[model samples]
Target: MRLTRRGLLIGAGAGGGLLLAFRLVPRHYAGALVAGEGERIFDSFIRLARNGDVSIAVPFCEMGQGVTTLAAQIVAVEMGADWKRVGVEPAPVSPVYGDAVLAARWAPLWMPLAPSLADSPEGTLARLHAEREPFQITAEGTALAAFEAPLREAAAAVRAVLSMAAADQWGVGWETLEARDHAIFNGRQRLGFARLTQMAARFDPPDPPVLRPEPAREKPGSFPDGARPAYPRLDLPAKVDGSFVFAGDVRLPDMVFAAIAHGPQGASVLSSYDKAAAADVKGLVGVVHARRWLAAAGTTWHAADKALKAMDPRFKAAGRIADSVALETRIDTGLRKGAGQRVAAEGDPDALLAKPSLSARYDVEPALHAPLETATCTARLEEGQLEIWLATQAPDLARRAAARAAGVRLRDTVVYPLHAGGSFDARLDVRVASQAAAIAKTLNRPVQLMWSRWQESLAGYPRTPVSAQLSAAMSPDKQRLLGWRTRMALPASAIEWGTRLLDETSAQAAQDAAHGKADPLACEGALPLYAIPEKAVDHVPLDLPLPTARMRGGALGYTAFMVESFVDECAHFAGAEPLSFRVAMLSGQPRLVACLQGVARLAMWGGGADASGQGIACQRMDLAAPEGLRSGFIAVVATARQEEGAIRVDRLSAYADIGRIVNVELARQQIEGGLLFGLAQAIGGSTAYAAGLPQSARLSQLGLPLLAHCPKVDVAFADSGEQPFDPGELGMVATAPAIANALFSATGVRLRRLPLLSEGF
Candidate 1:
């Protein structure tokens, strides 16, 4: 498959790591809750200061997930300046700067992971941040505030300080001076900020600077303000030209190459003794095995491999699994101890599932990030401190891990991110970085460790393999929903033991009892989404040992398939058109209903099912709790039957109501990319794993929708003109399900899985 989808404006931390341990960290984590230790360092973070330059002092690094772009977009939108007028760079950690408050926002909804913000009430932006609740921002969120807040604050402060200084010079009240664009005007003269910044910077620390807030908060116009231009991304020029700097692209003085050459046949670590064999490679540095990892050192990659081959005879495979089904059982059991975990219970789910119910099971296999680039992190000790140079997704996480590895304080480790080849959900994955940092520190030198393709594939964790089960009860009317019970599997990396939605202690028991049995992801859509009064959703999750992480796409894809397929099942029994039935059930769902109706209008839903193929799907992503950024999104796809048994996507359309849009074009692009990937997945999946490894190890084998496969896709945005919405991630939600629905018309198969492939009808 030739895929056409792209993600956020990350410097994607690293995508190639499964092959070479190149990185692309996930800037966006769907289900993982955010947690940070220690006291709040910064009362309020002012990471980016405007002086025609934008600097983001992030704890998280970009392995290649486009976080820099998101951060830049946020700051730029906050400042209400032209994207070109501002610049972006990472903020290094300091005693008074890192903000854990954002993690509250980061802690999650399902879009974030569920947090304890149930008691938190929404308030003004100031009060929201003043308290330690996570600060929320979408690319659009930052842009909206850019015009509304900070620029206004900065401007007023500048004006007030200039007015005070001018008053001292002129022997008048400070109010006597008025302000305009970048200028302080008094009855006698006017001074520009360029001229005043110098004077203001020199003011004594004791000088009380009375900053003024904009008088009319509801109004948008600032002094000499006009609307920001909505156009193509300013950074697109560099992206188009390949001049963009990514983490993998970063280079520092005296960087050495190292590969963590360890892992069993299918990704488990084995024993090895190749010290003598690797001794003769030119430019070859010595090899070391720490934590069972085989490290080959050299100036060039070729020399390292020679050394690695020399050491191969002494290797032994350990903890290897021969089959997917057997590993699947162990993983599912290990991931499901979360049932004992506490989550908000709207009703008694067990008592509800106690009645007779229809049920299904699902199992999602381990998938790789399979990015074009592999994992690569460069670490060096400089002046008694360690510095990291690479593309990392979660720079903050990497920084913390690096600090731990180096036995240094958080402030001592500096991680610089470069652009990334691509990122899925693992950009925030810090294991690869942590391993490299640990190795480098053990050697106490500057080393650029890059994972070989096999190491990248097997050594790193796979998208957490998931298992799910659902059972639901039908009411007498056959239309009303009675209850729902679901069981899922999770990996250790995703949830800490005893946390809500996570239970580590019972995972072993869960998997030990699950081998040779059905799994849940395979039946994700087992429950209907329609409103079922008194309905309760219960999940029994499994925990696994082979190290799993969220393959968000897999969860999403599987969930959609099960739900949609089940909806068809429900519809078939009800003897109603699926579209009409869905619409009827969603009567009061305004945003969703509107989006659904809009997509139908765009896709031209029909009189006959087989004549014109159509599919519909929607996603609702919660932004922040107090902010209340809940919004609905929907899309519909129109597919034409293959004329002569060839794969062809005739037309695709979508309807999205993300509340408000930041950059319309970027939003559209995001949605379009989502649709392409969604449709592709509905076809089968971007990559396939076997014996715990990705078959599509390189881009060549990876299936993607290229230009030839591009459909005539169009999108319509419904503003409802709402506030506090996350347009960034929601852009891609509607495309796949809608396309799958459309394809159902073409081929009577309700796609129950992803990557609707060529061979499959």
Candidate 2:
């Protein structure tokens, strides 16, 4: 039976209570790993071979984030395996690898009625949904928080059993044995894991497992300049040598290349195509027509693309066509006249905001994901079974979509997850899987479907466009912020994306369900982290004609830009320094305060005075973990100036407090990469729509920063004893506002919109 929210509610009512319904829910366990000869499987996360090699199963997609290496390092550290012998494999879909943390955090998307009941990883509903749907999604930087403890426990169990095996032969107690460097040691005697794997499989691990004193942690300052990581990325050598495989790199026997053309966003029905023109194209195999798209299969991708172009498929509009002017008008109307639903509130913001001391308005256009690799999927259908290969954040959901599209049972569908060139949350969309499945089923052979650049732009959902008005009520002196309120206008984007992800519904259906609803996810991070007495956030949902999806920074991307830029303006209005103003308000958050101070010193902050071109911004992100809330703090000091009629960022210095450090090198890489991504978003990454199609169809048209345009970036992490917080998004959320504030200092003109200077200066 399919699990729907309505079905769940009905079951709960019929069973008298949610507790009884949960008890009656069927539980699923991870299937056994396919082990090779002389290999022993330890739970769902670890496999030990007779050659002393330890293979860690990484459930997260490796979209150039080093997740595979990070996961393998965690297991290697806990199991005391040799780093050189450690390897990683893409984990199979299973309930044991489900991401309960992400499920809990996104509880509102699935269980909108009572999300609080499942607001934690350990919550009954969260666990049940995660396991049943097998929600092993890889977005939101929740990898470590969800899988760290489980990976450690699995490794530790393997270590314990191996030691027990060695102890049996050494005639010593297992407690006296130490496992390290791929061997079990008892004082001077040593036994390699290869010699004991068969015997260890016979012994049962200690109840609860004997975990190490500290779960995998990297020493601060371990990898300084010119120093190599203790556990280097295992995928690096292969990636560098061109042996690493991505979704687009997959090749199968008797595979035909297919190129697809999707209808424009609003006009999604195929009306006509020139079959004779396509038939004349060399190497053209056949054409497959779907409800919304047309595909041409050929021996080579180039030929298929040529055939698709020759066919000249046309689509008729079935709904209101999306255009830039209409989108802006809708947002403006919502912010100006529509009734807003209060999404977040504290104290009495209405009373204070009645007479605001300062106010600002901001706008953000739809930003594209623009990953290096476009959507590519290879599928084969044979004898009622369908197998697909793709790079997806949500593998199980993609498999289900493929199964349904191919008219096969979900159990008969097999998914082989591949590395992504880059996703930026784009892989969360599983439409390519269904498209490939349909094409392969029609061709009755293996087919590799690739979306062209234009098709990707036409079909891909960009980040939601938003308009917001922020107001601040200050003290009598206008130095201290007293109350804050933000009214944002946007579509219920999160719910729309969730419906497509969870329910596998059409975009229009999802938009229909989410129309005119208050979306807390859309307004996330609008509430300031500062010590304000009264604060509130309101969401005015616009019924937009276009669909939207999640990007790298999520809502925090725009919310931070608005909040930090507004704070900078307030600081200036009060004749205060930008850094000092933020520090004064951040009394409760010592970590963020430290980061602000540290970044200021790193950038040699000049108080963001006129023509100084130095500006400061900070942000805090709190994520729920097993051990309470995990918070990540970041501060960026940007030095930017107007050069040759364009914005040129000179340097960006950042300080981050991401709690405990797992892998210092990888952490630093993530921060640096996020900064570059933010720089891209600040400069371009966005596009305008005309006649239901994006004006910018190619990467070059998006105005992404070139290598020469990239500024010098310096990153530092605070030495905190807090739980590990993923550092993937901190720099991204903080960079844009910093740059915007710096530009204001440089040119003495405040740019309020994202992709700063979208409105001509």
Candidate 3:
């Protein structure tokens, strides 16, 4: 199926693998939860073995987001399985194991009534119909929202069978049997899962199984009324003890290590290599030429690296591949030159903006993922079937890329997902995985390819650079927002471009790249939630050669920086306090208003009499399906001061309402991480482009936020009593803008550019 914007969004929603194995016991005794062999195999998510082991296979790739735990929690809660006995594994690349994150992405953002878990049957069916095809991918924080219902239904179906088996065994009505905590109880007697598993396995599944509603949280947090799931992180212990297997640590018998010589230009074609200079290197196996890059195989990684460095390859059209000036010109032109595609518009914003208005332009430099682990993959082509092991967010994409590279059938390729060191969205690109497969296929031996720090930095896709302009006019009295307009110009994601460029014809790719979907992922947060009588939002997609891809929060992180910071500027122009101005504008969005108020309270906004300054910003992140399935809200109050010519963030407090949080600590951590990431972007996180190449390829040059640079963050979760939403990147949305606004409040400086300090503090 073609990956249109709709498809990309659907697949981009949160999507994982389990390391545990399922064992079997030879037994067959005869129920609704028990499934005959034929029918039991239908559900790819939950597998109940005769040994009473319940295993859940998640199609989402886990990169430290606790997806495995989430999947297990859903299944255990629904199936009544013991959390300790439950096993988690990565499901194979199959539509049967497709993710619901896509279904959520398929939902548009502008729909009047948001999609919810409580949608009527007709609404739910309409959503299902809009989803052209069910595919698997993990992104855009769709994991829990997408999989919760389906997984619960699957588990509940199994539980019903177990209940039926117990009723038959005890000669009692099924209604008398209660399945809880991995046991079936009938007043005075109980049957353990092991004994019941054998009987259930032989029973036929009910044609239409009765499913239960979501289970109440095992225990209450500070809010006793809040329902939350309690789960021990299944992937943590192994990681802490060093037993977790990341792709970097994987090994295979007689495996040959390969090092890549990346083209400085974005996916530059391989021209020539210095084979003679590397011929004398010890343990040097062979140098393989692959599309867009070169790989050197050796007995050891060091040997391969040494040989690769000695043989400096050159690309045909290498010099001045990506020029920062040229890119900026393109983005600027796109933003102002054309009739921009209107993402959202209401009333008469242009006419209102004709009056005296507050205007600001925010430019975000290219940012890199700079994940600690780097790009690593191990692949083998044998018996006309290709097998690959890697840490990737998109396993199915990797499988397809490998199949195409190896000239094999897609069904013949298998992708084994391992723990990722870190992947904001870099691993979603399959260039490295495809290259590794091609090299392995050529050598007829298992090949493990690991990009060196510099190569990975140069070859991996970075976040797209963008330029956004915000213009707004207040009422004649200067007490209310009258009109607002935001225009963001950004290049289409490299994934979309690559989808069209490689293998597929341009005509076919153009068809797949059609628009008319919800705002592109590259401009996620350009539209604001603040109530404005007249408003306009436009997202201009630039056609550029730069390799663009998702980085951390996709477009939301940067766009939020633009909108919120500009809003602060507008607040300043209106002669109102930042918090008060925002609160006043949020007339209809009570959830957003509450989030803003909550953060202000947490940060002690306007309470301290001291001269210390704080800046506040608020946003509502929409993960709801096209009609409004699920949603999230966030606001941040940042406290910072200039010290010795550097911006020092002293403290940060964030308030969030992402429905019902599953894990408070994990939720807090995600927020903290996102805030720090945003702060880093504001302070120094950027990729420098020069002479067609990214100059900042090393960690030191990338200027990642150090621990000492992090501010003391105070997080508060709003008591919305709603369904859980993805909290993965919510904390990042408001960070940059809050810091920028806070910096302005502290020094009366108007900064409108990212790597925020680059424009001068």
Candidate 4:
């Protein structure tokens, strides 16, 4: 009884209630499930029911990006349904809705030097699905590109079914009946969708669905004919009204809150706890123990927290914890271990670099997600079924991990993904869900497990630190770049977690690491965009003691910081204007050049430079178009000024070409928000560790950029017409590099490290 567009023909239940479910391909293993050629059955993505309500079972988690609204608008536009009567729920875990296209795209990006499977996107998707496993978690900005076509098709198929029904009732041609505003209108009369559903359910849909013609082109910001209305984000009203239910807001009958504590790093045993100390605490239920962690559930959060502090547990293998300096040393040592894998190489860089060449080394400290809401999950065992709820990036992964931890059958567990406070990549891991489920199963009651900011600070896997050594050789005349060589060290991080805990965020990285390869995502944008005769990039995967995962732009932000800064240095050495120098080298990549040119125009780059120096940087961001194509571009220019011996960003101008724009306003906001996030990181911040715990756990210690510190951000989108490309995560790609270049322009100091400080000035 899988939900499908065809299933809608089966009709609504008695009493005028309509429900249609979309099913993904069913599989015991992700890759094992494949669609046979000419197969009619498709994976379910959304369900529409009577009561003028449309329910979107979102395959991707919404981390405040307005995906729910955007996706729902697609269904509403295709179905001709009213936008005011729509709601969203997390899609159930299934292989049918797996991110095959996203996975396929990641494969080539991580192995850029490898031969592509085939020319066409469909061929590549088929090859990848047949060969490698498809990841199900959401990350890498694949939501819009992946679901748009399938969702539109699904909605269209349903619309066609209703049209056929309307045509039959009115004795008119099917083509003559049109769906609009939840009603079908023929030349003579109109039928509300509710009345037509009863008749539509009786007839079988055509074997091959007839889809509507694609909409005509319009301006970049315009929602072309038949495009989804850019209604204020569907999730925003509830959030603003305080009626939104985040993971922390979920409650159940007899629900008890729990606080968790860790023994040590890599600890997998709950030896024993101080039961006596916790027993005296009022409202304290008791301590629940799992293999690697312990939790205290109580009548109230305060009680649980108070009891948790009173207990102590031991572990078998205490993991190593290092201070910030020690952690840096560990990463540096691992980087020096080997040359690692060559991600991109062209010509002989070693030979060209034998001549005197400009060299620089760049390093970035580990940064935290540090969202307002900590990791939270609730689990309950009811009628032999395990129900889990949480605000997680990967619902399917969490479901699977919960089943394993709680000794429950995979099919018996249902996961409900709620709204997240924030989850750059911190929520990608499912250990929290596993912990909650274990406690719930042990107690035989509903358990709400939440981590304190301190606990999250210590345990949450943050962005891995990265260091790179880059050298560039110029021609004898110094007019052209001759060679480029970059050797970088980055931990495999979340990718090394193996198959038992596979997630979309690091699935490609894990696959690359398994075959002695560097995760392209970890080294993306490392190669120079400039037209250099000889170029090569090699990476060393550092297995750091701290758990590492992607944070925002991942490698793009860090790599661009180094590569673009180096471009500026080369420009300075060659006695050429920075913008002109980059423009000269970018002729090979016209699209990139165009984006850079747009940013230059917006920021007024090289316009006699302000007393407050301005810097420009550009890079290709990772965005998967709704058409399953992986192509997007972004460029940024940041201005900095000295204020009482401190460096302040005076202004930020970002230009992007995301193929096409979805919601013009949303795209701008995403770019602006990403810029601010990047600025927060660049302006002196680090998540340090000491004595086996996080030193900077609280907000104050993290040194997040205050609202007052943020500068005016101006954003511009290239007039790339109606074909929308990837939109989010593009703004931050070049932010740090541009700021660093601006710093270099302001002060003659070559700052090659992150946490950009004014000490150099």
Q: Which candidate number has the best TM-score?
A: 2
Candidate 2, residues 293-351, lDDT tens digits: the string is 99999999999999999999999889877799999998999899989999998886888
The segments of candidate 3 whose C-alpha lies over 4 angstroms from its true place after superposition are: 1-42, 100-134, 205-207, 216-229, 318-320, 333-339, 494-521, 607-611, 626-628
Candidate 2: residue 5 lDDT (0-100): 24
Using lDDT as the measure, name the better of candidate 1 and candidate 3. 3
Candidate 1, which segments miss by more than 4 Å at Cα?
1-84, 94-102, 105-191, 201-232, 265-267, 313-322, 328-363, 442-444, 467-493, 496-529, 543-545, 552-557, 638-648, 684-693, 755-761
**Highest-lDDT candidate:** 2
Minimum summed lDDT over a 10-residue window in model 3 is located at 4-13
Per-residue error for 575 in candidate 4, Å, reads 1.9
User: For model 3, how does the per-residue alpha-carbon lDDT over 109-228 read when each residue is reduced to its tens digit?
Assistant: 212145444232224432342221224667778777666766775676677768878989898877567788788899879998777765664454554445665553431246332234
Report the CA-based lDDT of candidate 1 relative to the real structure: 0.50
lDDT of 4 by residue, 212-318 (tens): 66521225446432346456688877889999999989989999999988754332346777878888999998688766677899999889999888886655544
Model 2 alpha-carbon drift over 4 Å, by segment? 1-32
| Per-candidate TM-score against the hidden true structure | 0.74, 0.96, 0.87, 0.88
- Clashing pairs in model 4, backbone N/Cα/C closer than 3 A: 3-21, 22-44, 23-43, 23-44, 24-44, 24-96, 25-96, 145-625, 145-626, 268-291
Candidate 4 or 1, higher TM-score: 4
Off by over 4 Å in 4: 1-43, 106-134, 215-230, 264-273, 312-319, 334-337, 497-500, 503-517, 607-611, 622-628, 758-761
> lDDT, candidate 2, residue 755?
87
